[model samples]
Target: MSLRGKRLFSVNCTLGLACLTLCCSVSPLFGQESSTSSSGRWLAPDALVTIAPAMEPGETFQGPVDLPLVLNNPDIAWDPHYAPKSDTLAEMGRDVVFRGEVYCLEFSFKPVRMIAVDIPSFTGVQRKNVWYLLYRVRYLGGDLRPQVEPDAFGNQVFATPQSVAAETISTPKRFFPVFRLQVKGIDREYPDEILPAAKRAIAARERVGQPLYDTVEIMKQSLPVTTAAGGHSLWGVATWVDVDPRTDFFAVLVQGLTNAQQLKMQGEQIEYLQKTLVLHFSRPGDTMDEMQDRIRYGIPALEDPQRQQYILDQFGVEKRLDHLWTYR
Candidate 1:
């Protein structure tokens, strides 16, 4: 077998061993499903939501950021261009001089789950409901680089307009995830928090022996590409506490899965936005006696055609869209 094949086989074996250890050794908590529940330890294949790496040509950025000379000379770091030479003209406009490559990671995740936890507060410790989203990502080792192709005749220096080409690379990738839960209509946003007590309770309740990382801890880990036989996956959970019980429809905005971003020129100022993943969900029935299991994935379909609009309005989406990617 070739070197690539041998490496893939080794990775597959390691993954299998890890799974076996979790399944055979981990003990389930009382009332915990420990298998296929939404809050279960192992991620179900049917519940996986996969988002492929994507970026547009316009999203490539090349301006004042990330310069070699700016690092050496701190005084000129604020300049649009590096320290200007006495003989050369200083760049006046904010236009991008040279575009750079855009690298994105392939992200996959399981459905969001809800759990109740005893957390601290200003008054004292109290039991509060928490919502968490589990996810994993992999690095495919390719980046989209801006380039111009030559013509068939080879006479023209540049035949086509500047475009992007895929180039293979091998390097470690990190995920600095920022998850926000937004409730439609009310326009309330809850950012994910790092709760040590909640994390321990969740690990036990989920019966997952493998260390599940929070936002900060997961950022330090590296991800590698996965093959058919095995997957080098990094598992993480985003937790939100004290969400309003009346929130029937909401979306989770996940960022940092990819390095793709957009730069919009607005007069002399520029607005920067990063690629984000939006996961849509809605719960049926009234908010009274709210339960964690009642939360369902995707937009809820109502039996009554007349009431469908009301449900759709709650989601703030025109149609039934489970998830989508956009720059925000």
Candidate 2:
């Protein structure tokens, strides 16, 4: 064989090895990008797909439409006829109730992310750190509604004795979510704030091309019913600023995803509770150095088991819970 032929063969072998090494390194990154990309990414709704029932039938106090009173003169005597009913009567006359069955939208979200942006404040425009959550809501038909049936007397009565029955309600539903970011232990709450700059930055960073609505704009969006072809899901972003950097444990409380509510009796007062979605998160490492990527979605039991109980206590759950729907 010629001397130049052997040299040429050696050069070709070296080039092939280099090409293979380059592909090996780039392949992992390419795969990661594909997985994280919007088209390929999806978090299942899981438990959030079910319906949330109302605590009790909503009640309206039956009283005189007009009250007998004299603003300027204090000589007006209280009339028994115009007096309001007693608490016992109010409970007994709860015949008029609303929202027998509350339909909750199916919700799924990505890990909460953080970004810094210049926001306008009372003093002046300042650079602020913002945390935002990207989420999608889908409407799946078949929610329980109050059902009625004919009794032995041939009279239409509620199938269940309690007036609550298994039923399905078909109608258009809207989402008006209220996001509250609460720091565990300290119990400091930070309500969601709309930061246009932070939202734009997040959209570009996350490569989200869909129209991401804020809390207000999301109210107008009507979630379409899911079908075999595809399930129509609406994407939105909830943002919060001025989060305490020293915070290690926090949870995002999402309300308005469902109209399910319960009437609570506390002494002489009545309290109304709404079904809310709580997303638990933990941030580990030194508090001085705050990094968005360090914030994790679920409990970090493996990393720090000591802090797990403290975080779970805040949500009133004994065990590890990443997300849950409860009356708040």
Candidate 3:
């Protein structure tokens, strides 16, 4: 008999025995069935084992009848999705598990890449790429509710279940065949050849310009008045200020260029001054306070009298000097 037939018989036998036990109060014969339930005690003719025809000492028996002792079918079939058709003849080397009710499966594969050489340039380029595919298949008719619950770490986790409500389902019902194919090398063309050409096209039409548009002569004429006493021109005072610099005032002057021309030129000068100050203070590993003190005494070349006066007014000379020592 077939494996399915045997299963059906076993199921029927179990049901019959259950019914007999239930009807035992009405029939006395039902009690006898319970007493003979142990193995080696025959409840039915097929359920009991019969010893084979005695083999002569050391004489072997091998035939169709002998095969029945070894032959046993587990009654399992390969999943249809990954299995090859009768015409295709491709064998699935990997093991796969399938649950007909839930219709979900997962597996792994290694990615492969193919490279090709361009005939004109003789340069190798990536041609094709393949990624490992793994999936879970689901039947459309079953419930597809999301199984989400908070985990111990206070994060939500999803569990795979056989069925869920229609409203809670998100994934589309589709057949997923999980597979790992050792795909042989195949050359497929890349799609980014036009990217470099596009970039070149944009670069050829770009424009560039400077910040302040005024002429250099206009900048010289707008120089601020010198605050030095006794016939000292602003240029002379600037020279003297640099010689014995007051660092704090220089920072204030640089900060006051909110509406000044020659902005780029002033920026370059400030950068140079900062670089020089850093080198001087860093030579012997001077402490932050000492470097700040040196900066506090350096004066700036200001080109606006009103801006200069504003700085002195907002922060008194002493306070401004203190700031130079502490300013970042």
Candidate 4:
């Protein structure tokens, strides 16, 4: 067998043994009951794929979703010297389809790394590092079931029990494979533009040595009571985009708050956001004026005394300003 095949076989053996051990330990009936009948069936190796934000010092994140695949390589070779005379080598490999929601837990300028390994033996065979993009991903498993066709009357239908078990048993393991993808080469648009602009604005303001305005307090007080509902929708859309796997979306959003504060300290963030709004939304050529107008009027509309307090209570001006004003 080739070196890669050998390594894969070894990993599969280790994983099978581990699974058997686990099954034996958990089931008391299997512990004392010995089966003299050897079925000659080999358990398949489990494949996993994982996505997440790049790791950072003092930060730890976990993903609940994991993509698992059962290997079904058919060209496996069995060495008589490595097994009993009657034993035959089992080959396994399979194509796995997976999808999930991803959130950014952290953001850094560092490179992202990914690794794929065979389980049980934990042998790493595939590795990649994305220099421009780093992500941590949690795999949310997908459901693959055959759908029943409707009759002429459009009646409901059911699948056979055997089909149900066949589908469910096909995806049993929860192993996660890690991968790092670089974002820089994927597009010509630089993702870092907004951040640096905000930084430069802050620096320029500080150089003038002028008194900074209390934009944080202004944002805090200007916060409308009904604005949170709209902001939540924005958050949901951002999460659905699967922008990056490694960072928590909530954390990134919070970072905007921090950036705002930093800009406030230097009297630049709000100004930059305002400038961005005017340049992008107020221009006669800009097509987004209608949306901007809605936002402008939406804030005051929620202030009506007849509205529910909960709607007003959840309003967040900082988030709105961040959305409407921030370049990013």
Candidate 2 to truth, TM: 0.67
Q: In model 2, which regions exceed 4 Å deviation?
A: 1-99, 122-124, 160-170, 267-269, 302-311
Tens digit per residue, CA lDDT, model 2, 1-328: 7999999999999999999878655522311221233544432334122223333333111221112122223344333466554333333333434436546666767777777788877899998778888877766654545566898999986553233222232456789899999988777999998888777788777754367888888899876665444446677899998788877788999998777766665543456787788888887755464653477887666556666566677656789888777778
**How well does each candidate superpose onto the true structure, as a TM-score?**
0.71, 0.67, 0.11, 0.15
Model 1 per-residue lDDT tens digits across residues 1-328: 9999999999999999999878867754421222244444454556567777766655455454433333344555243356564322222322335566676777666666777788987999998777887776766545665655666776544222343322334456788999999988788999999988788777776644356889999999876554333345666788988788778788999899777776655544466788898888876656566653466778877788768888777776688788888888
Lowest lDDT 10-residue stretch of candidate 3: 232-241
Cα deviation at 25, candidate 2, in Å, is 28
In Å, residue 91's CA in model 3 sits off its true spot by 44
Give the higher-TM-score candidate: 3 or 4. 4
Error of 4 at 310 (Å): 44
- Alpha-carbon lDDT of model 3: 0.24
Please give, for residues 1-328, the per-residue lDDT of candidate 4 as tens digits: 9999999999999999999888755621221111111232222221111222222111111222111221233345455777663454342222222222211221111111122211222474322211111111121222223345666788964332111221222222221111111122122221221122222333232221222112121122221111212210000001111223322111112122111111111221121221111000011122222222211112223455555343233333322221232322
* Model 3 spans > 4 angstroms off: 1-123, 126-162, 170-179, 183-328
Give the winner by TM-score: 2 or 4.
Answer: 2
Q: Pick the candidate with the highest lDDT.
A: 1
